[model samples]
Target: MYDVVIVGAGPAGLSAARMAAEAGLKVALIDDQPRIGGQYFRHAGVRRIGGILAPRFGRARYIHTSLSTLGRCGVEVLNEATVVEISADRTLTVAFRGSITQLQGENVVIATGARERVIPFPGWTTPGVIGAGAAQNLMKASGVLPGSRVVVVGANPLCLLAATSLLRCGVKIVAVCAPSRPRVTFNALLRLMRRPDIFLRGVGYLLMLKLYRIRMLSDYRVTDVIGDAKVTGVITRRFAEGLPPSEERLDVDLIVVNDGLLPNIELASRAGCEIEWEPSTSVWSPKRNADFETTIPHVYAVGDCVTASGVENSLLEGEIVAISIAASKDVGERGRLRRLSRLKWRWRRLQKFRSAVVELTVKESLDQRPLTDDTIVCRCEDVSLATINDALCQGVQDLNALKAETRVCMGRCQGRTCMHTVLALLATAVGKEPDQFKPPVPRLPLRPVKVGDWLKKF
Candidate 1:
């Protein structure tokens, strides 16, 4: 049994592991990916193997330094290890390669991170259509460009970063379509103005795009993606007030769409941790206190898994959670409250920035008219959105009732893709608010695990 088991290897997980190990706690860092860096700081190539770092110097350096520091700190890094289940007793059933293993830990830090949100449109499943974040992952981590010429669509700060990264990597951007309106909350704007570095970063992104002569379409939405196997172009419509309905076809090899991100909270929810829906990010995040401890004691969550904050905040949170856990064990001279206070200071600073950005960028609910009766909702299980609507029409208002009827959110993805859409449709059909509807039912084996591997636990 280890003193701490970190269930991811991103910036947050790495920072947590480093702190735990430095505090003399036995730390085991596990991740499904082949390397230490999770999606945000994804590192490619073998250690000591030669490869060119992505032009984003800060991100690349952070990943490299953190991995090296973790190694030096004696943290046992287990790459490509998937945690399939977490028991009440803190036993983690993990699948590594073709076998399964049970690992016990006194404390657990879940840093599973966030997945990019992609809203389906016509032809979205095509090969050339991918999430804006996924495009970044492909270019930054895999060293493979999503396309030579691309059209980026989204309203997040990450969308701008993705565009900048693509330009640095010599990928030509055809156009950027941002659906955000010019008018934002005054409070959010004021908070953003206070952070000069963040404001400067925003300016720098605009300047880079200007210098590269990339076309930008503010208040525009990608109505449809056009192509067969590969994307040839995207259909876009302007969102300005009093604007006539004009459709434009922008020629591009790839369409990178980013709506926003939702917490990858399946494991936490399945483990019976309370989840709270945040309208700002339009997703449920695991409930945690000031010290990052969840409703269930000893199960802490850090990083994007708990909040919609970005990488810097995630790393700070990880450090805080680790210190808190260490203090609980009386491993160091530092008191828990004192360590927590320091973390709170940093967290407050970052939260101001995150709140401002989220307020300014989160997508408002667009026209989500329910899909046809036969339209598929859960792509993983091929469950139709039509079937889900039919169940709701038959008075199945509760999520569990709908689950029993249509099994829309009961697939392998476990409602990750269809939950929000299903809830929205149900609310529309029943004349209730989306938040008023019951949340999706949580289940175990939060991630897909082989049946044979699960049986090994017995």
Candidate 2:
């Protein structure tokens, strides 16, 4: 038994584990990735394994220091460990490197982070089309560029980051076609100024774009990805009002697109924690109280898994949740209340900024381009928009019902890649809000665990 078992090694999980262990609680940190840093600090955990340090910088250095602190605090670190199941008694069954082990924690923290939301366009499943987050993972983890020439599409800010990262990697960007108009972009930029650090980072990205003389088109949406077997080019259409409609084609090997980020809440939902859909972000997260404790007693969720705020907010949540858990255990009683109050005040203030960012950036709905019947919605199950429409015609009224009729979310990904799009379709069909529909039933094992590994648990 451990005093605390935290899932994920992202900013929140790392901070929580370090703080809890520093308070003298036995702690175990688990992550599926071989590296400790999540998306924001991708590949930051690599050290001088053979006496050669990786090129480190701001994000990398901070994570390295936190990892070192975790080591000094005696936290058991389990990299590449997947938590497959959680029992009613709060025991976690983890599959690690072809074996299984069970851990019971007095307190458990879920910080699995978020996944990139990809809005489907025609031919999106082509070999060269990838999510902005996935493109970053490819570049960061393996030093592989997504393509020689790329066109970024969508209204989200992640598109800019991906384009800039590709620029740094010497990949040529053909253009960036955003669906939002110039006014929306300007508003978001003004709101971004509230956080100077973020504002500067975004400005630096824009500066790179301008310095390279790359084309940045506003109020343009990707109508289709034109390729037979792989992406060769993309079809973009201008959507601005009071302007003659025009179509443009860009020759490119890659199309990197992002809608937003959605919480990876499968583990928490499967563990029987209550979940609520937040209309503001259009993502469902594990329901938690002011203390950040989930409906399941002694189980807490923080960071992007709670909501897809930025890295700084996630780090702060980690500290607050750890302090709450430690105080509950009476391990660090002195000044706990005062520290919690101060941290929460900071958190709430940051959340206000987050709200403004979301308001300025997040659209009421995805790109309003007409989704063709041939567009692939669920790649894993090979479900198409036509099939979904057929199901809706047959009286499917909710996501769970639609899933039963069409098997959309029953694939290996467990709705990670496909749920948001399906939810949008269903909500539109039913003439209700996204939150009005019931979420798909949570299934287990949360991830695929081989039969051999399960047997080893015995």
Per TM-score, the best of the predicted structures is 2
TM-score of predicted structure 1: 0.90
How many pairs of residues collide in model 1? 1
* Top-lDDT structure, candidate number: 2
| Residue 150 local lDDT, model 1 | 86
lDDT of 2 by residue, 357-420 (tens): 6876636364386579999999999999999999999888777778889999778897889888
Per-residue lDDT of 50-115 in model 1, one digit per residue for the tens?
133456435667777776777787888888899888989888888887678878888888999988
Cα lDDT for residue 324, candidate 1? 88
TM-score (all chains, Cα) for each model: 0.90, 0.92
Please list the residue runs of candidate 1 whose C-alpha ends up more than 4 Å from where it truly belongs after superposition.
45-54, 184-186, 333-340, 366-376, 383-391, 404-407, 455-458
What are the lDDT figures for the candidates, one per model? Answer: 0.78, 0.83
Give residue 249's error in model 2 in angstroms.
Answer: 0.6
